[model samples]
Each structure stands twice: as C-alpha cells, then as structure tokens.
Target: MYKHALAAAAAAAFIHLPSTAAEVVTQWNFNSLPADGATGTGTTAAAIGSGTASLVGGATASFASGDASGGSSDPASGDDSGWNLTTFAAQGTGSGTRGAQFAVSTAGFENLVISFDLRHSNTSARHELLQISLDGISFSDFALFDADAGGDRWYTGRTVDLSAVAGASDNASFAFRVVSAFAPTTGQYAATGVGSSYGTSGTWRMDMVTLSGTAIAPVPEPGAMALLLAGLGVIGTVVRRRA
Candidate 1:
C-alpha cells in the first residue's frame, strides 16, 4: 500500500504537473521617456522608436523604446535576412511610407507564442499578416489581409493572432513573427501616385515584442501504464524461467 501511495504521488507530480506557459526571454521598449517625466529628462525626441527605413540584414529587435539619439540598431544599412534576429517596422504612419514585415529563426523554437503591441498612427500603418515557423526551415502563413492590417487608424494597441499561421499542430517547437511593408507600390496608384507610402502623412510604432513558448517534443508520462508494462515484462521473464 505504501509503495502504491508513493507511486501515485510521483505520477501526479510528473504527469499532472501544472504547466507554465512560456514567457518572454527578453523584451524592449523604445518609449525612451523617463520612468518619471521630469524636466531635463531629455526631451525633443520622437518619444517613440527608431523609425529608420531599412531591411532586416540580421539583428535582434527590442520591443521597448529608448532615446533615438543613439537608438537605432544594427543590420543598419543592410537588410534583415540573417536567422534568429528580426525587425518590425512599417513606413510613415500617416504619410508616404506603407509597409510591414514578419521574420523568425526556427532553430531555437518548437512550440511558442509571440505577442506585441503596435501603433497604426496613420492610414499606412495597418497589416494583415502573422508569420509562424517550426524548425525555422518549415513555416506556415497566417494572413490577416482580409482584415485591415493595422486596424482602424488612431488605434494604438493591437496584437497579431498566430493561430492562423500555426494551423494544426498539437505541440511543436517554433517561433512566430510578423511581416509588413509599404505596399500599394503599383497599379492605378503607380501612375496616379496612389502608392501606400503616398497615402497620408504619419508613422507607426511597435511596443512590447515578446516570444514565449516551450519546445514541444513529446515527453513520456511516468504513470501506471509505464509501471504496468514493466511489471508485465518481469512476469513474462519469470514464466519463461519456470518453463
């Protein structure tokens, strides 16, 4: 009875253990504003982020905003192609820049969840995309194009849903990211000057980019089934010995 009781507890602790949803390994904010707004705390800045226009050559992205004076990050003049590192920025919120992008490194992730806030300060700030990947080599697309990319303008807080991208997988190690860019570059707007960048006169901002989730390789459960199998093997050996 005592042995069985101990086994029960062991099984409960391991198999039924409470799970903690994975959370941010790291995060950043470009809102360089001081923890407390005070005089001489550094003003005249964009109070948002490094709104520079470039490609994701290969560099890590920070969600929190900071002083633009030394704010911008690397992969600077190049593009964002390297793995693991990524960038999320759309051109002019209300002005002549319209774009967005999603990227990720599949090597370090399997099952994961990524969340972030965005400011569609203008017409060109909307995006309808969420990128999901497993093994970084295989990826799935979650297109939100049917809905307004950035949602209603003047709207400052919005999150991209990755379920569409993940599709169907009980659990898999993976990373989820976003992709957006200045579109409407052609068509009637091509000659008429109606491209997305030319839509209005503003810019957008991203805050709180977080990646959290567990690598989802199946783990064997230590339970009665396992113990029973072991016992059955032992019994079979004994019968063979007797024979």
Candidate 2:
C-alpha cells in the first residue's frame, strides 16, 4: 500500500493538462539596433514571442553598445543583437534625466516570471531602480540596487516573480523602467541619479530580457509520464516481493 501511494503521486506529477505549450510570452534580444551607441527618443517596437516588445525612453535616455566586460553573458553583435542602455544625463534635474523603459501587454498569462541582464560603466557607487506599472503612465517602485560597483565582470542578472502584479487581465498593459537616482538633497548619494560627471560620460547596458508564464498547470511530457509510471511499477513490485 505504501509503495502504491508513492507510485500514484509520481504518476500524478506527470498528468498533463490540455493545450499547454508553456511558450514564451515576450522576449527582447536587442540585436535589431546598431552596435554603436545611439540614444532612443521614440519607441522601438519589435514582435517577440507571442507579444510586441516596445522599447522607449525620454529625451535624456538612449540605447547603445559600449560595455565589453560582460563577456559571454553580454550578447554579441549580430543580425538580431542585444539592446544596451547608455544613460548620459544627470539625475534629479526633473527634465534632463535619463533612463530606459520597456512596455508590453501580458494578457492571458499566469505564474509569470520576468528576467533580464544588466551591466554598467560606473567608476563609483551609483544606484539604479527597477520600477513596474499596470498602466503605462504611472510607475511604482519594485527594486533598487547598485547598477555598477566597478568590480570585475560587473554584469548582473535579475529575475522577478510577476504573479501578483500581472493578476488575470487579458489586456494587462505592463511596463518596466530602469532609472538612476534623481538629484540629491543635503544628505544623499548619487545612486539613482547619474551625476554631471556621469552626464558627460557614463553608460549602462542590458540584454536578454524575457517574460514567461504558463496558462495552465504544468505537467511532464507524455514520454516522461510513461517512464515515471514504469519506474513506480518497478518499485511497487520490489516492495511486495520484500514483504
């Protein structure tokens, strides 16, 4: 009976739901743009996976390619290459700040996961923020971390669970923004804001942005399920023989 129970659970793990592809919802390789540094003023739209990837930024922000220290994690220059951020403005100016924004529609998705790779060319500690929005206009804070600490191979990776923010909306328009710290007060660091020193010369790069989720509960492949069932059967037979 005990062996039988284990076999049942194992088989259950392989039970598949109907029409589950587990396809990628959205992805951005950024290979379409030129390798040289170019500031993005308008929206750069591309069809990715099952949705459209819209890359946009303000007047101060643009996408360029300069950081070479990312090594293998950094995407190579190709036909469909990766997009890098080149923030070349001071923060806290309100009007003359620089950041990168990506907007997309995540409809009919559940248990979503959002991830990306980032690298920076900062000489000192500068903070950058990752924000999310349900509507494209207003953004709420999500994560704040050091964009570049000037270490070896400073390329960093982040993965966020988007289950709560995504909810169950068919036309849920989601947006993500990476912004440097704004102008500082009497007692503040230049973490989020790109300094004037940076304004003249500083850069950030990003690549391999992806969003994925399952519409239905995940199950093992048919062949895998069959194998699991067979293994469980073998275990049960062995247990009975021992008893």
Which is the leading candidate under TM-score? Answer: 2
Q: Write the per-residue lDDT of candidate 1 for residues 79-176, one digit (tens) a residue.
A: 21111113233233321212333333333233445555544433333443455555533545543332243322222233443434443233334444
lDDT tens string, model 2, 145-232?
6654452234445677766764422446777776655423422335323442344245556566677776754456788877877877
Against the true structure, candidate 1 reaches a TM-score of 0.42
Cα deviation of 208, candidate 2, in Å: 0.8
Q: Give the number of the best model, judged by lDDT.
A: 2
lDDT measured at residue 213 in model 1 versus the true structure, 0 to 100: 43
Q: What overall lDDT goes with each candidate model? A: 0.36, 0.55
